[model samples]
Target: MKKNQSKISIKDIAQELGLSITTISFIINKKAKNRISDEVIQKVEAYIEKVGYKPNSAAQSLRTGKTKTIVFMVEDISDPFFSSVAKEMEKLAFDSGYKIIFCSTDNKKSRAIELISMFKDRQVDAYIITPPEDFQDEIEQLVSENQIVMLFDRFYRDADYNYVVLNNYGSTKRAVEYLKNQGFKNIAYVGLKTELSTLTDRFDGYKEAVREANRENLSLLISFDDVKSEVGNKQFEEFLELHPEIDAILFATNNLAITGLKILKKKNIQIPEDIGVITFDDRDLFELHAPAITVMSQPITSLAKEVISGTLKLLKRKHSIQDKIQIVLDGELIVRKSS
Candidate 1:
């Protein structure tokens, strides 16, 4: 504890901990989730405390709320649905005098919990989360402490929190109903297997519509872990092989639909002739596909506006609100050559 010690910059801490300056920077700035090991974060943070090193940003945040930063945590940043929403909200948030930083939770409870805990060590003014599995207790804790949180994509059915999501049940139901009207028999559902409400509601919707239409409720639920692996491809292939009667498919997510298309193409299956296809999310590539894939397009612009405006409203009235903000938007069914 010398009075005139030279300023201990990030370099000193980096070398002392045997880690890179970038890693140190990420940890110091509370941006190390999923990229840096938790053990490394602990070691680096402990050393910084031991050396009495304080980042200027940290000090300033203590004075005025960390420059009004918001953490928009979603399942995966690469997903077109989530990415589009983030892009739509970025400028709106900044223009409102707040900064938005994105982090992928990978739909893992452990990852989400870690990100939630990081807010404990720093000042993250608000959170727009597409949460993973069970984290009700963590979310409730945030609300108890007067933190700004907005849940998107899916929500906790048992927990009351502000959220904006699509009409998962109705959207899938209508899509499947349309296919049935078009003489699509044995319609199969393709989607990632998760407890997420978004996918679950879609399945329920499809299931109900198929039940009423007197059609078999056929579905292939791929594991979240296998979304990118060949295992998923094999599963889908096997499902298709086992169910040759399937004449139409309603994919739950964009990536799942992409996988379906690739497999179908390799098998020389013709769209709208061999099988009709409809995906949940809209993307540029979907329309650019050979047959111009059909889709249930979400309200991307409206979603962005709702989430950002809702966040700003929540931020303005941090803790005095009694009622929760809940919004559910409808999806548009865009028919194309594929269906």
Candidate 2:
């Protein structure tokens, strides 16, 4: 009743109402539909509301074997794409009576594995991951144990896991084609050096477009570990200097684009004049830039909805779902002055 008082418990409610704890629990767990009378249910409900008694989640998890918690593993939580998607997913999951724990893999396989094991130890109900390369064995093990798993943003081609992804290849291809149409002759791609399918597809898309146009493929791949470092900036500047013929650049990820943009600015390279630019993932900073960056925007809202819905379906069905689900959503190419 006090401002800083401890939370009221089911036992307290039972004691107050002169009812057994079992009866209170059955009602609280919504298992009294036909077995319990309406009068007793109404009394219990009224008393619960009056006292604001809350059931212990840990105890409930033990009794029901459902923790109602999900782990969302991503490469970088601070990235706008992942963070935006996370916010939406968290809201949806919370509304559906589940909580989400976001963990950044930092594009490290070892870190991802450790987080996966930790979440497993916590008995999380489900997992939504943007997995790193060579981590299929751990995911496969989770699947084998009948754990609900949903891959998002990226996934392994060989693994049969439920996933929600963007059309990486097609989007990047279109972006390149658009740049070509804008009369940019030599377009180069700056991408992360990781083996993520998302980055690979984008790179492949760039290659396809360049090959089709009879233009030489000019691309630079930076290691993920060095992506945010000054060394990456130097590498990108060197790549640009080495390929003077490259009049345009397509960055594979938002971070790469941000880095490239800074380097370009430092060198006084005018966008759309000296080097046209288009990024894969959209960010607010991109839109607010001088020339306003063009980008292949992933459907963050749709991705969140589908991922959460898919995760919920798996959690509800538990081991009943045999076939893996894969949903690939389209990305929109937002044309801006930079391109």
Candidate 3:
């Protein structure tokens, strides 16, 4: 029988250098701080280079009780808005010594719950959740367990958690009022259900905008569970057959707005001339279009940095922040040809 090659262990390194395992482990892990001689450190470093070594993250996490990992749970990764946010977050988190894992729930409550449980079981250092529902008890349990949790882009009035979000109500209201200022009378609202507080807030703003403009006859179209691209196309086709007099549209999210753009192209309707458009979340598609899109642009860079910074602070157990405080960053309305 051929002899098998045994993997090198910290014990082998310690024995070879005539040092204790604890000293070897500490030196390998870069925890050497107890006035160890430079000569011994050099010897260990030289030996480590001679032998190819790989550190196991799981083992290190078990020893230190910190994985230095963050979970970013979003409603849908397919949406360009959320994808951009995730990219920005990954960049910032990586720069700050944290690895980020993304989860796309597709706006399903069950998937959201499953991802949260998996991350918790894996002992993720922190979570930045744009959850599918207002999960108060689960989040509170996380907090009680000394896990850092931060909510982003959505708010639950009853849950006491750290959060960073846009000024949804104010921004949506402003977008509508701007359309009204441009003389759009029959503005319609297109969106999904109210599982997320941002949706509810945007709806509230839409109603407020209509009321403030004294447009009582304005139509409110709610796209129940399905408001995705295909669903929006079918809904819009049916919507036009019934309510063809709508002069403008205010999309609660950018995906709805993009879908609306496609529908308009199909109907051969000119934007801002025949129908005006405004939506939340701006991206290159909206920016570079012929009739450039008007949008409520969230401060993504600032938001990403703030969320990560807040999460890290919580992880370090530095200080207890003000409870139920909503950091509502103002959104800018970038105006172009499409209202």
Candidate 4:
């Protein structure tokens, strides 16, 4: 209670409680390997409060060689699909005694690389990435160094790593099949243009549906790599103008689907009545819109669990486990007025 007291330290708390600073450190950080008595721990903690002692996370991390943190790098954090996945992953990581930080690249390759370098220097415990462009080389290097890097929602062409993704091919095929059954003669597909395995798989499903329909009479319009609102909306508008008779559009992701809605609204196009809409992932805005939008929602919780468990398994391995699991969870189609 002095007028100008200096900053408190572990030494001060230890001196006041008649214990060594090492004991106080172990008890406070819950690293009491020898099972320090409850009474001693309580006394140290109480004295810590009395002296206003605080532990420095940097120092603790240096001593333990563990940040106890995981990082998730995604194309766009604002995108409904990534946002949902981030929330679930954070919750699961926290429950398992780890923290998670989300890094959004906006689908930029350079940005993703910068974050990868930064996280590496910071010694993050693990990473889950939806990489940009040809970052598989970078990811492979990390994996070779025994870093825990799990691919989520996407897969690399020549790299072997853990991944949790939805069954993109089957889901999109089902969506297109549904539209065809509803008498939609002109079906279009909209999504980002990337070598990303997920988008490619979904695009394959769209192609399969077209080929299986055996309808040379039906029209198919495919749009790709529409990331931003302005770009996406403009492209969608141009497509609609060029093909005025398109009956249904299948979006590869929720962000593209949202942009499609904006363009359709501006053009005064009626849903299902004029142009049917079905998006890949669901969000709150989709449910609250004028006519609730339908979605093919991924199993976010299951995906998170799978990735986290896989990372833990990797961390426990003597060498990289050759059990490369490409888990393909299902996406549910939520039908609404738009479809």
Question: Which numbered prediction scores highest in TM-score against the true structure?
Answer: 2
TM-score (all chains, Cα) for each model? 0.81, 0.95, 0.86, 0.84
Which pairs clash inside model 2?
Answer: none
Give the count of colliding residue pairs in each prediction.
0, 0, 0, 2
Candidate 1 has an lDDT of 0.88
Runs in model 2 lying further than 4 Å from the true structure: 1-12
Q: Model 3's lDDT to the true fold?
A: 0.80
lDDT of 2 by residue, 227-261 (tens): 88989988998998898888999999888888899
Superposition-based RMSD of candidate 2 using all C-alpha atoms, in angstroms: 1.8
Put down candidate 4 lDDT per residue, 189-300, tens digits, no spaces: 8766667788889888888898899743232223445455466566667777878778888988776777778878888998879988888888889899878887888888
Question: What's the lDDT for residue 200 in model 1?
Answer: 92
Number of the candidate with higher lDDT, 3 or 4: 3
Model 2: number of clashes?
Answer: 0
* Ordered list by lDDT, greatest first: 2, 1, 3, 4
lDDT of 3 at 286: 90
| Candidate 1 local Cα displacement, residue 81, angstroms | 1.3
